[model samples]
Target: MSRIEPPSTDPVNSKPARAATGDGLDPGGRRRARRYDPDRKTRILDAALDVLAEHGAAGTTHRRIAASAGVPLGSITYHFATLIDLRAQAFARYVEQQSAVFEELLEVVRTREEFVEILVDLVHGGPARYRSAVLGFELHLAALRSPDLRVLTQAWTRDSRAALARFTGPDVAARLDALLKGMIMNVLLATDPEPREATRAAIVQTLGPADGSRP
Candidate 1:
């Protein structure tokens, strides 16, 4: 019988193969690792809000948020260096999205009655109202303890007041802002929530007639 030839061991003829692990270098010397996700930062910020809404700021952490975000733990730090930074960005996003919703709703209101109806709908019922209510309280409470967060809250208040000022004038808009805040809190927390009509009346009372006449 002829002797069987051993397999060739020549590196020059061998096919290129990737590293089993580590840096994932291929035989051709190129890295074969997964490409970085461009939207990972936004995902992390959104996940941070979901975590905050569910667990409050105290319960939000890199590991928990990483799992929630479906990202590597390192990605959290890669996007936001500190928990406070993550919270701030998440809250900023929340405020921006909420403001956009308000703008959309307010844009279609041609009269004071329509504006009151919109505010009533916002407090009594609307999309994501309850979830936003919870997150709003979480952010407000967190801001109490964080001066940096308080700045964001103040900015949010200024924006809301500015939006209301378009209809209520600056003086009434400030009071209306306060009224809306209180009404929202009551609607979210009270065992017997105020009726939509009652809320509307309260708004009208605070801001006077929505018929263009200043209160």
Candidate 2:
């Protein structure tokens, strides 16, 4: 059963006695309708993502997510059938959000140098967040074990590479995507990162001089 929160009291006290809850009628054994919140599910999913980023999939629980979301435990069961279901939906939401982040990185690139610099910044940790990396790592690990998650992973990879392929072509974009992932992981784990110039040089080396060459 859900906990009924007590309503606020007025500064001046009245002669008449009042019920603890203003949520519904108290006397005469009256029943009340459930409260409505249109955005509760979205908030739950967002909270689940936050949980996933902070803790791995294994550590994410319905109670944990409910507490993070400030929703009731019943809400978790109401929205998702199982923990795996909730985790999978949360992972999907992360991918959707990250797709936008990835697209924003390439939105203003009109030159090879601009692209190279963006890649360099990415390699050197520009807009990327520790939380994003943690979520990505958890998603990848989960996908490895579940074929269902692999579908989402594959689609994300395809879209990400396609975005890059707009500038670097399919072949180089694939390699660059792989390189970027590796370099990001290296940067995340390294005690001290290499010079920013080294990152730029690596990107420039990957792209080669601008020839407007067609594959």
Candidate 3:
């Protein structure tokens, strides 16, 4: 029997295979990269929120979010199948956070002064808080295009209006929610140097009764 020579082993390139695990590409030799962790999903989602808020839904791509989160591009899809999936999750988180904050504010809101003050504070933020009011509106506009988003948005509106109705009447509360939404859109687009007074006045007028007393 002819002696079989062991197949000549060619050493991997000294530079190290660019296709290795740390190279960001997935395990199947595909160029798509991925990160491994449940936390990574949340991190990517949060990063996507920041990117989307900064650049709008049109600007929110997997690559952008991965770069922001310092993760691999494929990691986004590992957690979310489509951009809409990510956007839906991000919007859900956004609404949840806003609800929690507003609930806190509502706890102490006895008069229009306090209510408006808290609302403005939450909207405007302190010098140190992340101020992305425009970005928030961008997300809202993006969500309006999707049915899944509409459900969440409507639920959020219904819950909030119901809460407000506890203070104002149901009719007034529903109207107040609509009025506030319009005011928010205006605030996002307005160039006025000081619209707080006008905004506050609008809120007060909506909450106050016809003769400044409950019916």
Distance (Å) between predicted and true CA of 16, model 1? 40
Alpha-carbon lDDT of model 3: 0.63
Candidate 3 lDDT by residue in tens digits, 122-199: 545543234345555665686576444665566567667866776677988898888776666665556863367777
lDDT of 2 at 3: 19
Sliding window of 10 residues with minimal summed lDDT for model 2: 1-10
Score residue 121 of candidate 2 by CA lDDT.
Answer: 76
In candidate 3, how many Å is residue 120 off? Answer: 4.2
Q: Give the TM-score of candidate 2.
A: 0.81
In model 3, residue pairs whose N, Cα or C atoms come closer than 3 Å (at least 3 residues apart or on different chains), thus clashing, are none
Candidate 1 residue-wise lDDT, 1-215, digit = tens: 11112122234433333222434456888856756699998899889889998899999887888899998666676566466667778888888777777778888988767888888888887658988878888989987877566766776777788888888888988998888889889987799988887987888898774454632
lDDT of 1: 0.76
Candidate 3 has a TM-score of 0.73
The estimated TM-scores of all candidates read 0.81, 0.81, 0.73
**Model 2 accuracy (lDDT, Cα):** 0.75
On the 0 to 100 scale, the lDDT of residue 69 in model 3 is 93
lDDT of 3 at 108: 80
For 1-215, candidate 2 gives per-residue lDDT tens digits of 11111122222431222223433444666855667999999999999998888778888987789899998677777677667777778887787777777889889888777888888877676444767877887888998876567766776788789889989888888988888888878887889977888877777788766777532
